[model samples]
Target: MKSSVDQIRERFDNDVERFSNLETGQSATIDAPLCLELVAEAAAAATPEARALLDIGCGAGNYTLKLLEQFKQADATLIDLSRPMLDRAVKRVSAATAGRVEAIQADIRGAELDEQRFDVAVAAAVLHHLRSDEQWSTVFAKVFASLKPGGSFWVADLVAHQHPGVQSAMWHRYGCYLADLRDAAYRDAVFSYVEKEDSPVPVMTIVDHLRAAGFVGIEILHKHNCFAALGAVRPITGG
Candidate 1:
């Protein structure tokens, strides 16, 4: 069975220090630091005049902090499932940005975001936890609703492959990367947790969801191994 939400929260609550570093990002994820930079730069380029930011599953707020460097005057809203994670993100983000920081301890699946409120929204290494198609659709739609016209939403996360052979090949590569990063034990542990907790979808699936969510100008920023980063903009011409 998949890990329960409470279990996921408990795990993150104790792992704040691992996620606190902006330099490495989540060490377990492939090209974590690169994706961080990519997402931040892409968001800045896409919404150069952004004045407000929303970070779903903010974790230690690394993504938000990076974006703050670009949107120096933008207020930030951070949401996460673990209070400790949220607290750490708030502390770090507040220190980095002169703009106001708002932290909410809640899952993205059910978080109530105000409509047309933000210029940029980012979700990093977080959406993979979404288990069902409906959950994915709902969260995408909600994130869409929360952004202002011409706003953008960015995502960097592990992604699945539609073909079984391709998925296996990617999974194997990811496993080798993990083993090389540490040891076989570490790789097994990471694999075990993913099997029990994650339900990532393919990059194409995400694109379809974004299209259905009313986003335009979709762009795939990066993809390496099993990870990918992408963004889509809400059209200024539409409601």
Candidate 2:
């Protein structure tokens, strides 16, 4: 069985220090620094005047903190399942911006987000924890509803491929990368943890859900191995 929300939360609560770094980001993710840079840049380009930021699964606030460098005046709302993670994120993010920093200790699946309140939203190294197609659809719609007109939502996360051969190749490549990062034991541990804790969908599945959620201008920011960064803009013309 997949790890429960409580199990996931506990793991992250103890791992805040690893995620706190702004330079490297969460090292488990392939091209972690690159995705962080890409997502922040793309969000800035899409919403240069963004004044309100929502960071789902904010971790130690790396993604929000990176974006804050671009949107210095933006208020930040950070959500995470781990209170320790939230506390760390709030502390770091608050130190970076004079604007308001709100930390929400709750699963994004159940977090209540106000509609039309945010100019940009980011979810990095998250979303893969979502277990069902319905949950994915609901969360995507929630993010869509929470954005102001022209607001954009960005995601950087582990992604599964639809083709079996491609999936095997990517998984093998990711395993090799992890092994190279540390050792075979470390790679095995990570692989075992992911198998128990994650349920990622294909990048196209995410795009389809984004479209169904009323997002436009969907763009693939980057893709390498089993990870991807993507974004979509909420239409300025629609409700």
Candidate 3:
């Protein structure tokens, strides 16, 4: 049997039937609008137009759908580990824009993404899947190398709180968000799965890693409980 991380992809592939009750369908967080601002900033700085966007861990393609809408002329190269999610992404994004859309069903960390290849990169609720801080840093560098100068990387994810009392408060809110379902066992199972598979870290660590990877002008776009969005830019002049 596959481990939880492997199984999670299969579950996402089956998400169409389960999305009604899952967190996957939730709207973007309050700080998400700031991500759009960063995207627009990248667009304005690009030579021709902001026409090449990359989406990492694009589960079921929700984030890509938003990018397609925002840049109708931009093409997308979406990377994910699950083939089912990639297929679904293609179907959802194909008709929405005239720009080219391609899916690479591979792990983004080892994928062959060319340097200066994209104008903007987006990742949502994805980095927590990496098993360690080292792996997280590697993925950050991979993304940093994949962007063009002046390109920006936008990420939305859950992070670990540095303080224990604050951590409890954040978990309490996360639990409350699911409390309406009123299925204690179901909620417990979900969190148990998360505890076993997810390796979330403080957003500050990510900021440091992005800086080491050559991202400048970094900012935290928003924070709500444990969930937040962050934006970082690859400077316009660098090798």
Candidate 4:
């Protein structure tokens, strides 16, 4: 039996472009230009003294590259669990920003995020991958602690619906629709990978978890069916 991580990597490696394109179709991807715009907006909203940005679960540096493009002055840290994903992101960042971004490979659940703090933290297409409510809480708490007072955390991923059956139907439809556009082998790999036994957490629960972790002013900035972007601000007084 292959480990879940290995299986995921194999699927990704087999059809990176197809997978990227499928992901790009999501609200998070469709809202990429807008999201980057919002990040700039958030960065501007922060005190002028704050300039660093941390991108949690920065797979393939999609958002990381956009952030650098949108805000040339701000430095960014790209964190993810997959080394190959991080490597790709590093290359993308280097090509786009001439080596202005940093990359770190570690699980966001318990890894020490270094002493470095950021003015803003962004997690796109993540959160759902976490296996438990406690894991979600732990990651959010880490994000909260990694930020400066009044800093912002922007999170984007697939939101959970009230009806699991409806959600499953939508995912199946979308996945099949996308797979049709790609090669058969690639499509099978993606479908097989997604149809795993243990599903990840839903999006609404993640928002609740974030609030439980002490974030304030939580709101969904964008939504496209199950895909959405959410954000909250760290309290100005708390550690």
lDDT (Cα, 0-100) at 206 in candidate 3: 78
Ranking by lDDT: 1, 2, 3, 4
Clashes of each: 0, 0, 0, 1
Candidate 3 Cα lDDT to native? 0.72
* Model 1 RMSD in angstroms: 0.7
Give residue 154's error in model 2 in angstroms: 0.2
Candidate 1: lDDT over CA atoms?
Answer: 0.94
Query: Each prediction's TM-score against the native?
Result: 0.99, 0.99, 0.85, 0.78
Q: What is the C-alpha lDDT of each candidate?
A: 0.94, 0.93, 0.72, 0.67
Query: Can you write out model 4's per-residue Cα lDDT over 48-88, one digit (the tens) per residue?
Result: 45567788877777676656655566777888777777777
Better of 3 and 4 by lDDT: 3
Which segments of candidate 2 are over 4 A away from where they belong? none
Q: 57 in model 1: Cα distance from truth in Å?
A: 0.5
Q: Candidate 2: TM-score? A: 0.99
Tens digits of per-residue lDDT for model 2 on 80-173? Answer: 9999999999999999999999988888889899999999999988899999989988999999999999999999999999999999999999
In Å, residue 61's CA in model 3 sits off its true spot by 1.3
Quote the lDDT for 104 in model 2: 86
lDDT of 4: 0.67
Model 1 agreement with the true structure over 51-82: per-residue lDDT tens digits: 99999999999999899889996799999999
Q: Where does candidate 1 stray beyond 4 Å?
A: none
